[model samples]
Target: MKGPIAILGARSLLGRHVVNIFQELHPDVCLEMWTQSDGVGNVNSVKRLIACISEAELIINCHEARDLSMAPDREALHFHNEQFVAEVLRNSTAPIIHISSTLVQCSDFWPNTYEPEREASKYGIALAVKAYCKSKHLAEQELFASHRSAVVLRIPFLYGEEDWGSPVTDAVMAANIFGSIPNIGDRGGAFQIIIVGDDTPVGDVYDNVVEAVAKNPKRPMSTYNLPFLPLYYIYLAIGWLLLAVNKIFDVSGSLSKMPDPSLLYLIFHHWTFFNTNKSTNLLPDHEELSREYVVKKSRDHYALMNPNRVRTSWQLHIE
Candidate 1:
């Protein structure tokens, strides 16, 4: 019989994609999705959630708040994973993979730039993660506490789009919507950063969880950094290419006269990919970003999402 698979965070960005991929790859398996809705936690939606958890052989927890600047419910976040899920998961002997963020790594308290989930940066996101890391780490601890099996992927700067949340480029295009805001900073070309533009095969991180869980010796939860610098370079090249097009067609003009570098940097500089032992090892096997495809895809989606917004960003193709 096919194995039973439970996806704890089906409604999340990563959860949705992973679910689709898993279903496509393993169609025959029993696929169960769990997500909180209408003020009800995962169990509320399905009265048999605990039952499902008890019977399922593989449970992938992708449920977690991703916003960096925003404040999350510390009490709630900790309880869900530790007190609640821990109790339910304790009964199961199957392997469980918990999807976690790398907000913990951005710290100086530790001797190394990339330390375990224990030593996290205490600034901004890292600060926030530090508060919750204890719980997330505890969750991981519980998952392995029974000594069944577990894997925790410390992801950073995830990219791509979802039906609800705008694509990564959505932020980039939001300002461009009303036409150029003026170049308040440097003029030659404004450099905007994208998510760690790293070509790290993030997909492999997912794969490693599946592989690690299946094998023996119960793989220890190892945290990997999905660094950021790569996504920055990726967006830089894209920006330059666009500038070249503007020069060729003489499409240079200002709407507001001075573009706010601060505003632009807010969107650009923080975009990052990750530095993961798993992603680095796995991405090499797959193809990286396709700029041409991404450009077309991003623009089309942007237009659809913000129909009334100005379309000057597409002047190259329109007129």
Candidate 2:
């Protein structure tokens, strides 16, 4: 609780937020950061990471390929995700907390998986996403198979203050900035999604990691699903529609950015979002927020960014 904690992918939204959470929760704890932009997969970074592992009592891996549409080939993903993890396992004796995705549950590629849903091979998931899922699945498999002390948090559509990017963020922008609500044709929002960590703030994830590390269970690894977000299909629909409009019209007057439709469909149509019975049982202090709570928080953040708003005579700061 008072020493060093090394974090990989520190530049990522999750990584940055986790670092903040550590500082807030454990003021005395020392933090070491590594980022892909800093050449994490390079030889020098390996040496630094190895050194970090040697000194730190805990290591948190928040690295992931966020862009599914432009990801490298499968082999490259494996090298980045699987081989990188293997290297960490080889050098580190400290317990690791790996941030993984719930999308892996959709595929049969991962043997001995705990997902309740059937394999999603028939679901027509995009090629890049399938590769991404395979990469994460393999990493999880590697961690467990290595017989090391690790904990895997299978997360879903994460949204909170200072998010780097996510489908939920896109939705917030559509609603708050463009004044366009997502509408999925005539589906009448006949869709269900279980957004893990949707209600729980990103800081809570770090808190859970800290608590798990404190316990130091003798088990090699434990896997737990985060909180399930209440389904709000219509809102997500609006986000998707807005994203679609942005893509076709290029109305943003910049890079045409939006969550891939395949990914959106996967979350809204295919993936089975579940309850956080396991996480809640283990970490009782973590709270669950309603959709209204997240929506309101997002709106407030955007309001401060609105150009027409005047707060303390300060100009709006837009991302």
Candidate 3:
């Protein structure tokens, strides 16, 4: 008999979706959600988390600090997981699938290889972003070292319908409604936006998680990046310019009410994209996500939900 599949950090945006998908996929399989803070109905304590983990057949770690600014505080960045992850590895005989980022592949220096299996993230020191990358690198190293059954998914630039506040959502809304967007830097700058286009949808990630749970391997400790999305910054840039103009004029544009000049540079200026050949070959259900489809879906959904609303920040009120 298979034990229940426990999802850590189930209160997260991705975590909530995964929980719903898993229930629909396997109604007979018991599902448990755990959060560091008070969870859905009751307060999920450390004891409860451990108990649930002890009995679960599998664990999926969706607990990640999305804010890159927390890099200065190492403990907070790791989420006090020095013993938590190790504890899980020690207690559970089941495979643990951890959600990681493609930033770990980035080097503190430069001339970084987009490949993850190459072990290119050797350097780790700098600003909040670099520190965040280093934390992920070290975490993965420890996880692989601790348990061979552990698996890591290095996702890059995730966008989906559930997150209506994402930068992509802002760009799409501004484009479809206001026809205005802003460029963070000079148009003719030498900084070429090189994204692996590994912008996977949450739905695809959900499917991969379901598959991993179904096939619980004994010695399956490995990290895999989701399929890549090709670079399409030009189209986005045009959209931003339109939104930026509307913002400057103080129009009733949806994105105009939000931040001006856009925050797309956070990703466009950097190269955290990854090579997904391994994930595509390994995960049979893995598919190359269509950036257009995702953007359209997010745009349409947000328009319907908040036709007159505009968001300046992608902040969430976690309980």
Candidate 4:
């Protein structure tokens, strides 16, 4: 009999969705979920983690400190992002799948290669973002050093019904409340954005993890950037206009508030995007979602959550 698959950080935005999907799709598989409340992120809790996963055949680590504002200091970032990973590797022998960020790949240069020594300063990325990136990079290094069977999925900006604080979610929230999106930047950089719920990249993430668990490939480590729809910063202006129109016609009588500027640093600088050729080659049957479909699906999901809100004229036309 196979042991259960343990998911650490099971309460996260991605973690919750993964759990739900697994239950719905593969109900026969046993799953153990651990979150911050379970002391999963605490270095002292490694012993507890070891005990919990002792009977596990696979461990999926969705734990991460992603919010730039929340993880303000370097030590905090290192503790959550890198140190915890090292601790897990030291104790666990189970095949692991780690959820990493594409920010680790940010560079001003095109065709960014995997260079551990790459500095964030070269791309003029902000200090907080830089620290977060460095920590994720170090965590990856820790995994690689262990020479264990692990798969790292580097994902980009993710938005969904439950997502908040992320760039995409922030924009949506700001638009709904203030009728204006905060200034992101001069619109010079390239980016990729993906939805996290229902027939989106969340399924793709599951597919990759399933493949890793089944194959249990005997390589030191393998990394893949999940597929995404490429988007430029300039396209935000159109979204802003649509959001403003929706707010103006909203009958909910909700007063507008000022937009929060906390996440501005993440987008205020020029940053490069990832090339997912490796992921494509590996998942040849994977279908890429069109940008229009993603946008409409995301817009509808958020709109349904706030049912009193009216759709913009432009949005209706597009629909």
Candidate 5:
């Protein structure tokens, strides 16, 4: 058997993408999707989630309410997730993979270098990231305490088709036909990226989850940032080009909408992080890391998207 499978909160934007990928990988497989959409802010919503955990052999939870604008009821969300993991460990034997975010990575980065450990920006965006870390940590710890088979895949910033208003989404939207970017005073801090590919770093996170399920062993939880090839400079160049285009054509073209306080700053500041080195050690023999491979893949992806005013990639793919 490839595996027993289930996904929670499968109706959300991210959840839908997850579902699409899972199905694409395994056709003819029964995929059960559960949502806490109605009355999700209450305890009963989570109780429904706990009940569903009882019947599954493997569960991948991609549930989240990420909004930088509104302060979430962190305690409520934390309690619900914590209890859900606790219940899964207590009643069922299946392993679980909980989706987390790079917002949780705490690393330092040196100004003159890409030494994240030495010069981390985790603190820079720390406040914006706190609640996500707290809730995910609560649930992860319980999975460990109960000796459950589970892993947490802390995804960094994701850039792909079908994402609307995502950090990259705005940039992709704002790309100008002039092949130039307007001068924007501020450049955003760096966020780590995870490149999706076959036999990917995800294999590492899943290996642990699968092993835990098979062994019923208590494992120490660790985090890895699936670093991408495009550094902060790549995004900065894209920003510069946009400003130049706006200057040349006297048009915003596909550039991002300027927010009232500052449109460009808001777009530039949104970032995520991850380190895949740790995960690299755990993958099966079939997959290997190649910096060149990822860069090539990403470059092709950007070209295919074609950041030109003539083609509406945003409307076609990102909405």
Candidate 6:
């Protein structure tokens, strides 16, 4: 753990947090950062990627294709998820810490050979999500097959101050503007969420990564679910009330547009929460944030970003 550490996808949401946390707490540690803009995942950049990590003692992969557009091309997903991972494995012998997603567990196409099926898919999950999950599952398979020292940290929904475009952030915005969330079937779906930009969980994730690098466990690869708090879809109503109060005091502004049905279904319809017993055992110091705290923080952050906009209420009129 003494040498330089390489971080792939250094510009991504989680990647940025990882970089900031490492720099803040361990400024002396050399960090080698590579991002998509730097051609880390391009087919023609294999040699460049190899050279990037050649001197690193540990590699942390935060690269992922999160664009779940309609009719997403399968090749694009594979190229970003599976093929890029394979390239990294081919290039670096450094022990790796990979950031993965819990959505893989909810895909119907995910094979049980890796781990037990966590939940059944709801009827209307977008095809883009299915394709993304399949690609991630394949990436995990690639890592397992490499027979290298690696730790896969599978996480649920992430929210924070900078994650402005994320689903949870969008929900908070919609609630603030409309004073209500669209009640998708069954009051939406259940899921788990964790804050990536906050110090507590980010520190926990970084601590586990450091342990993985230091220990280089005897097992070729280990998978752990990051700590999360359970959140039901209906709980989003809390944001509506919080924002409504802010508007009553003339402290918050409004924005238009509700989340698309496809995105809404993805969040509200699937059961994406997973057990974190293994991660807690690794580092039991994780703190849990209350739902109210998350809602209020998101509200204040949004209002600060859009402070001058006019306020709106349930009557579909600007105040």
- Best-fitting candidate, scored by TM-score: 6
How do the predictions measure up, each by TM-score? 0.56, 0.62, 0.60, 0.62, 0.52, 0.63
lDDT of each residue in 25-82, candidate 5, tens digit only = 6776666677755345456865666566666778887765542222334555554556
**lDDT tens digits by residue: candidate 3, 1-319:** 3548889878665677677766755678888777767332233555677777888888987775543321134554555333456656766777788877665555423533445554534543422255455566666777889755887877654444555344444444444453433223222211111112224422222232212221123212124322212223554465566657665674334432322221233333333335666656644241454655544554455445442463323322221
Cα error, residue 114 of model 3, in Å, equals 4.6
Cα error, residue 316 of model 6, in Å, equals 31
Candidate 2: Cα lDDT at 217: 27
For 1-319, candidate 4 gives per-residue lDDT tens digits of 2359888888877788778867866788898877777664455566677776777888988887653432134666678888888877877798888888776666533434433334445566533345567788889878978999988877765665565434444434444554544343344433344566322322222232212221122211224332221223333354355457656675212211222122232344334345565544532242464545655655555544441343221110000
Write the number of the candidate with greater lDDT, choosing between 1 and 5. Answer: 5
Candidate 1: worst 10 consecutive residues by lDDT? 310-319
Worst 10 residues of 5 by lDDT: 208-217
Model 4 misplaced regions, further than 4 Å = 40-47, 69-71, 108-128, 182-189, 197-271, 281-297, 304-319
- Indicate whether candidate 2 or candidate 5 has the larger TM-score: 2
In order, what lDDT does every prediction score?
Answer: 0.45, 0.52, 0.49, 0.54, 0.46, 0.55
**Global local distance difference test of model 6:** 0.55
Error of 4 at 189 (Å): 4.1
Which digits, one per residue and each the tens of the lDDT, describe model 1 over residues 1-319?
Answer: 3768877767765677677766766688888776654223454544655655767888877765422211234566665656655655654666777766554544322222324344342343433334455556666666666776777777654443433332233333433453422112122221221222223232322231112221112222223332334644554465556557666664334311222222233232332233455645532331354644544443344335443442221111100
Stretches off by above 4 angstroms in model 5 are 38-51, 69-72, 79-84, 87-91, 107-128, 170-189, 195-273, 278-319
Each prediction's Cα RMSD?
15.6, 12.7, 12.8, 14.0, 13.9, 14.7
- Which regions in candidate 6 have their CA more than 4 angstroms from the true location? 40-48, 107-128, 172-189, 197-266, 282-297, 306-319
Best by lDDT, which number? 6
Q: After superposition, how far is residue 310 of candidate 3 from its true place, in Å?
A: 8.4
Q: Residue 286 CA error for candidate 6 (Å)?
A: 5.9
